[model samples]
Target chain A: MNELVGLSIGSIRQRLVDCQLSTVELVDAYLSHISSQDRALGSFLHVDADGARAAARALDQRIQSGDDLPRLAGTVVAVKDNITVKGLPATAGSRILAGYDPPYDATVVARLRAAGVIIIGKTNLDEFAMGASTEQSAWHPTKNPRDPERVPGGSSGGSAAAVAAGMCTVALGSDTGGSIRQPAAFCGLVGVRPTYGSVSRYGLIAMASSMDVIGPLARSVADARQVLAAIAGYDPDDATTLPHVNLSARAGQTSLTGRRVGVPKEYVAGITDQEVRDSLSATVDRLGAAGAEVIEVSLPTTALAVPTYYVITPAEASSNLARYDGLRFGQPSDRTHGHGAASARLRGQLFGREPKRRITIGTFTLSAGYADRYYHAAQRVRTLIRQDFARVFDQVDLLLTPVAPTPAFPLGSVADPLAMYQQDIFLAAVSLAGLPAAAIPVPTSGQLPVGAQLIGRSGDDNLLLDVAEGLEQALPVSP
Target chain B: MSDTTPTVEHLTKLANLELPTDEQAALAAEFRRIIDFVDALRSAEVGEAQPTSQVTELENVYRADTVEPSVHARTLVETAPHQQGTYFRAPAVFGGQP
Candidate 1:
């Protein structure tokens, strides 16, 4: 069961095609493993054992009948609770949405289902994808699979933890600002923050509308790319999704020859941890050795990213989260008082601390007198930050940097919100630029796994994954 | 550019949220810190840079005017906490019985 659970998507597909593994058996292994292990990890919020078993049985019948199989046949995936999966509770890791089972699947979920991916359950996340750590989840924090005492980096921490611990073959996670990549980095998995609007956000619980993207977390770069290919494309429902976009990496292309890889000086200088800095240097060396030209590039606006992200994200979140008035599909409010009072009381009682704080900050920023100074100023600065990436992309094909300043820290160690926001110092800039970035684990010698981030030009998701795959092969094996 | 600290009461009211009295002071301080942190944007030399609300440069995506089948009203109303014959029930807006 452990060996079957540990198979990659590629191996699983091959074995399934060869009739060596049955879909029901694989799904049962995962369901049983999750049932026993997820208690300690807190990676899953809701397990759809019946749904998974039913899907697996149907797929097994299809395989037995020699019917044409879908691309991701027999692969089991865990979805972040924020992405709706019709009839499944889509909590976004908040108590406010406790009993709200969505009426329909998110666009990505629909696409994944069509491609033959069986969803095992809804994974946990930071409430509304707000915090750097899963500690802010209204239910429970996900422990890092690498070190159970530490948190799995979030808000996609549960997704990362699930994929890392072999609870599922791959997991879907939403990245507003480093939600996917940071968690993947901490959990030692390959996580992609696909180009903004690359994956449809039709049913994803909106965190920050502009920056929100649904991507994949998987054990391998190939698996992440395959999942991205299945979910990415123009969706009429999402006007922002780019038309005629190709998200698939060209097969058999792993060489980094002639690729210009830039090591951002700003990212390197901001790293206070010696181990993480050493890992970055080692990754740069590997990139150079793999026949890529490595250069030091400066993104001066990097320092402004976290501040800009915080401002823009909260502003959008306050507006997006306004819908949870309890009249609709969420925890109902006590109407004994009045409508206005009930609405306020419902939000106050159900919203997690981080969401409330962000709502307050957002409301304050977008208020009449302060909008120009805080909101608009941050937007203009956001433009500058995007320009910084644009300029650097002109000089280099990709930027190599550490995913976070440090690896997974002990749970509850970083208490102050200000210090917590600073974790995205390296991540938020790329997100602000709306470019494709992936976090792939590099070899770590007896230390907590540190991931190296690869940022690509907008719409260059294929190139980013191809390069990450190349680097993944070139980097030394972790002991 | 004056350091005008807005009170939490006013902000939460605008946000349609309420906090317990004991937590208000801590939230106020945290809000101030966040405000001060984002204040760094004021120092950026962003003269004439266009404010980017949406990253995708696409504008005004339009579909065919023909209406398509949408989610059934009954299905949506079923998810509501309170419903009465396909209509979602809500608290009274104007001081009256709901």
Candidate 2:
């Protein structure tokens, strides 16, 4: 059973194709593992046991008839609660969305099902994907598999934890301001945040629409690449999706030869631990030794990312979250006791502190009196940030940096909102530029897992994943 | 700082949110700090550079204007907090029953 859980997607596919492992047996193994293991981790919110069994039975029957299956056939995948699955609960880790199940699957979810992968369950997240720690989740915080006392980095914390704990073969997580990568780094996994619009966000409950990107967190870069291939592409329903993106194709280069990896000096300028810095420096050395030219590149506007991101994200979030008024699809307030505005206020009260804080700040920033000073000014600064990335990419193929300042902090230790917001300082700039980035685990000064971030220019997702794989082969950190 | 930052009550009204009175003071303080942090954007010399709303080069993406099947009204409306005879119920704008 442990061997089955440890098998790579490539080997699993080969075994499944050879008829050595029945789809039912594979599903049963994961289901049992999750049933026993997930309780202490708080990784999964709801398990689709019957649904998974039904799908497995059908796949088994098809296999018995000597039919060929897709590469992802018989694989079990977990979904973050924000991404909708038909008839499954997607709470987005908020009490406001209680009892609400999406009527349809997200574009990615539907595509995964079409490719023969079975979704085992939906994982937890920071409520509305707002905070860096899962402690903000209304339900419960997901504990790090490395140390139960520490938090799995969030809003995609549960997805990362599930992968680390071997609860599922792979998990899908949404990254808005390092939600996926930070958690991936903290938990010792590879988390990819694809280029904006590379994957459809049709059924994802929007937090910050422009920055919200759905990606994979997996045990290995190869597995993350396969999962990205399965879900990425254009969708008619999502006009923002790129017209044609072949995320599944393997990059031609296997080595770092002739590749220029930029070390962003500004990314490490702020307060960071010695251990995390040492790990990043060592990874840079490893890349250089592998024949890639390593050079220091500066993103001068990096300091503006947090202020700019906070402004725009909230400004967008306020608008996107307005649809969750008590009337249509959220925790309902009794209308007979009040007027429309009052009832709406009551419904909004269902949200946790982080979501409320964001909504308030977003509303205030976009308010009539302040829009020009806050929203417009921030948007202009955002342009400068994007231009900075473009300038650096002109010098190097990719940028290497630390995923976060430090490894996983103890649960509930970082309480202040501003302190919590600082957790994504190294990552938010990448999202601001709408570029592709991946977080790969490396040895840390402390026992906890620390990740090194690899960032690429817009639409360079395939190359970025390839480079991440190259680094993975060179650095070789145990998952 | 107090004059520039919106009070918790004022922000709650604008955002259509409600917070308990006991927690409002602390939340208000935090908001003030965050707003102060955001004030740093004023330092950037944006000049005549146009603000970017979306990064994609694609603009005005349009489909064929064809109607397609959507989620069933019954299924969709079921997610609402209150519904009566397939119609979503909302609080009345005026002081009366919805």
For this target, which candidate reaches the highest TM-score against the unseen true structure?
A: 1
Local error of candidate 1 at residue A45 (angstroms): 0.4
Q: Kindly give the number of clashing pairs for every candidate.
A: 0, 0
Candidate with maximal lDDT: 1
What are the RMSDs of all candidates, in order? 1.2, 1.4
Residue-level lDDT of model 1, residues A1-479, one tens digit each, is 38888888788888889999999999989988998889999999999999999999999999999998888998899999999999999989999999998899999999999999999999998999999889999999999988999999999999999999999999999998899999999998999999998889999999899999999999889899989999999998888888878887344577998899998898888999987988888888888888999999999988889899999999999999999999988899898877888999999999989999999999988988889988999999999998888998889999999998888999999999999998898889888889999999997654799999999999988889999999999985562
Model no. 1, DockQ: 0.81
- TM-score evaluated only on chain B, model 2: 0.83
What TM-score goes with each of the models? 0.98, 0.98
- Angstrom error of the Cα, residue A16, model 2: value is 0.8
Worst 10 residues of 1 chain A by lDDT: A244-253
Question: Candidate 2: deviation at residue B60, Å?
Answer: 0.9
List, residue by residue over B11-84, the lDDT tens digit for candidate 2. 77877776778667777888889999988898898888789888777888988878898888898888887888
